[model samples]
Target chain A: MFTGLSAFPLTPMNETGIDEVAFTRLLKRLTSAKVDSIGVLGSTGSYVYLSREERLRVTQLAVEYSEGIPIVIGISALRTREVRQLAEDAQKAGASGVLLAPVSYQQLTDIEVYSLYEMVSKSLSVPLCVYDNPTTTHFRFSDELHGKIASLQQVRSIKIPGVPNELDTAKERVKQLRTLLPRDVTIGVSGDPYGATGLNAGCDAWYSVLGGLYPDICLGITRAALAGLSESADNQSKRLEPLWQMFQKYGSLRVVATIAGMQGLTDTPNLPLPLQGLDEVARQELKNILSILKNEISLP
Target chain B: MFTGLSAFPLTPMNETGIDEVAFTRLLKRLTSAKVDSIGVLGSTGSYVYLSREERLRVTQLAVEYSEGIPIVIGISALRTREVRQLAEDAQKAGASGVLLAPVSYQQLTDIEVYSLYEMVSKSLSVPLCVYDNPTTTHFRFSDELHGKIASLQQVRSIKIPGVPNELDTAKERVKQLRTLLPRDVTIGVSGDPYGATGLNAGCDAWYSVLGGLYPDICLGITRAALAGLSESADNQSKRLEPLWQMFQKYGSLRVVATIAGMQGLTDTPNLPLPLQGLDEVARQELKNILSILKNEISLP
Candidate 1:
């Protein structure tokens, strides 16, 4: 079962194309921090903007850099065929799992939604993680649907955004889901700052976008929690509060890339068209926060 | 430039996979109709749901059936890279043009939107048609962005859905677009039953989802309008009234597929997951409407 911190690494793109050098550095940082798993080509990773070749390359690089650590590949696509192909690619690249978001454009019926998961799961050999980020997908997976998807032979986990208002509801649903799903299957929380409470509420894993830049702090917190050192975990969480505040201030995508930039994982904090990087003032603020966090944690 | 009817054929799927026989038959029907052009793998064609291979097969079949007739391939994908690759495939398949919608999931910035069009247009050798179906893409192309895309070297046309409140605004925008775009560059209005006025308002083409099922009626209306026979055009418009109402009642995606089913195009109205087919009652009603139109037009 997945537990502790899963870092969604930022995709680096320079004028020449995907910045593999920057990506290598980012991967080394995450692996060194000993994150439970590293997720690639997700929203924070700017998967939507990258071409199929780029996505495949990023997945391969993540697997390579993660060493023995599990690498979860995001296989979100507009069409099932493409998603299936990407899933196949991910498995071939040695990713431990694939994360899928349902087609976002149209509202799918319950049966349609179930079939999408079933088809994708059947097509793949690797364990599937159904990503339930309704904010981007626009279609929320109901508890009943979640239960049904969990029953699929290949689906071993679900990653849900930890929005506050829906936190309790998701918790209740996951609690019931635990009964329906196999004992080994995991239920993970995304949207980290808000997810801390959900993790405490018994979610099997906590996914952190901010962890891409501050893996040490994220790992520190996870290690503290794992060792049952509540006071130390609280201190790490408090120390990372300013960075989380920046995430809240900047949009999620921008903040994610900006954090990656502060960690020197990427140069420009560039996002694909429709999404832009943070302005100079915000960039500097993010840098300052990273500096403070590094000093406090004595992160190399 | 694209003044007549265009049939967006429904993709055929069977037990073995894409039903090439049914696909060929459907394409032959539209080609025999002598449609001004054929839009392959469009919304009416179930573009979003098909696998990359299925999409390519449908495009190739349409091109083969039409011989020299223009074929416009729909290129709507969540990832920009897939869109580029699809554009290349469309070009290789001998498609005359490619229609691209903005990146489906993310709310793109104006600059990102511009860059998407620029990149796709640059990648393909054929003329590109900018498709702005905000209903599905969830991202509206502003007049400024549309104008900028129109100005791109390879962009030859645009397809805008004619929603009621936005009709006049679309007309005014198209008027400005005409000035910015090349004289030969066409502006096509989708949502055809409701878009006749936009055609009259000077759009170069009327793209129809209903045309897939009712090519005879669509062609008749187009011919009448081109001949300046307003009364005849009005009569043909009246013939489409019932079917248009059914489209509104059944939901756009299902109704488009149902039209293909009614025309003996495909079995099972295969919508990829998330979109369901019409109920039996709606299907029967659609069949009845098509029967009436066929008899009225003396079409086989």
Candidate 2:
């Protein structure tokens, strides 16, 4: 369930709150694309920006709408108590797994991060994915720390951030991580642009942001990479270089939310407050890029 | 109101929830010490770990127990809506002011941060202090960004993390910052060890963690520095070098919570979980250091 491509969709919101209609539309797209898992409330899903009740509602909505696809809910919170509660809520709502990150205000120690996983893992009946997202969470995991966390009974996957741009170095990095984690503990790649390289580098899954909106293309890369067609996978991903550039330049959340809005899949200003959607220039640029991509590449 | 020694106390918690008795006792200590402001739910107060209801309750408690002393509530949240709500709650609860940090999960852009402060500042009736603690919030403010945020109407103070250790360099940094801020906006320094030097360098306030526990000693340093007795203030702070060392070694939150627990002001495991108190060895070292300090330094 924690393998292949885990499509992370945004929990689109309008002023009234979580846009259930738009959220289900995104989920239906991922389900139809047959992505291996649907990851809701990941950073791309804006989990930390949500209240517990809203997060739980999103969880239920994801499970209900994914059409039998595995649901991995991001259950990261600053408070351990809240993380545990969210983990339980995700399990109760029928999520296949929960993604855990050492989300903190006080920069957490390695021991503190380990303890967080240990405590949450014990309570979770479902599998827990260690969300090693330093860009957002600000907690970096050493290989030794990863080894310790992976040793926890319920921790079944580690979603790493981007790998090195160079394929050889990416492979070497993945190999090093593999030795530290158990064989059953899958290594998933995040940071959307690095998804193809990481998958070709022996990562078992792609925990992707792009996969949320354009699952078919992400899956094209994931399938080719997993089937050992490195060049084919690279070409598929390279075709979307324009989208990748936008993700890097304006942040994946804002860039993707902008695309979703332009596609009419979500309301304008879909992101939560404190996160403004892209400006007119960036939005126009994205619109141009989207039109070009639609002509240049096939998207479901 | 946003000047001098602003003490940040812990909202000491037991397993059940916020220990009101211990919280009020800590509040009383700050009140009796006559610290210039009582800063509740600041990082030292574990605001990020608290729920909105708990935070609102803490805000009211601080206002009630502060006994006419100015109350500065830390109204930081991951979401802007929540931050605005927290600001409104603090103002309605009779807090003298509110402090805000750009608490984010999706590492914020400068515009997003500025927009956050602008929106919240518009909603706030009470004065707002800009909290620039990168160690926790992971948001580094460029001087230009500070100038932009300080331009907002409700912004009355800036809580800088630390100044340089050398008095001259510290003075230069403060002077540079002062140029970017409005004349009425006070500059407060955090990072406890640098408190005396920052004040001597012309910071108007000390947003202090240690002051929350031992306000008299912190006040000793604050008073001497503001009175232009640089050497005297430095020496006063220098006397507590041992405690400062511990704070640097372990985090201030854990070390101070340990002291509070040992002093019977809070329950044994005072910090919210995932943040364990000091281990046995550190606790023993603190015990010996406390005993020695009691005999050497004049502490209240």
| Tens-place lDDT digits, model 2, residues B1-300 | 989999999989954689999999999999998999988999999998998899989888888888889999999988888887888888899999999998877778898999889888998888999999998888899999999899999899999999999989999999999999889999999999999999999999999999999999899999999999999999988889999999999989999999999998888888888888898999999999999899988753
TM-score of 1: 0.81
Measured by lDDT, the strongest candidate is 2
True contacts kept of 1: 0.53
In terms of docking quality, model 1 is acceptable
- The lDDT values for all models are 0.74, 0.91
Candidate topping TM-score: 2
Stretches of candidate 2 exceeding 4 Å from the true structure: none
Q: What is the TM-score of chain A alone in each candidate?
A: 0.89, 0.98
| CAPRI tier for the interface of model 2 | medium
TM-score, one value per model:
0.81, 0.97
Could you give the interface RMSD of each candidate, to one decimal? 3.4, 1.2
What is the Cα-based lDDT of residue B93 in candidate 1? Answer: 83
lDDT of 1 by residue, A1-300 (tens): 367788888787853468889888888988887889888888788786676788899988888778788998998886665677788889888889888987566666677778778888888888888888876787778877888898898888888777343546755755876776777678887877755555655677778887876687677767775566655665667776887688667656787776666555578745554456777888888778768877876654
lDDT of 2 by residue, A177-237 (tens): 9998888899999998999999999999999999999899999999999999999999999
Cα lDDT for residue A109, candidate 2: 86
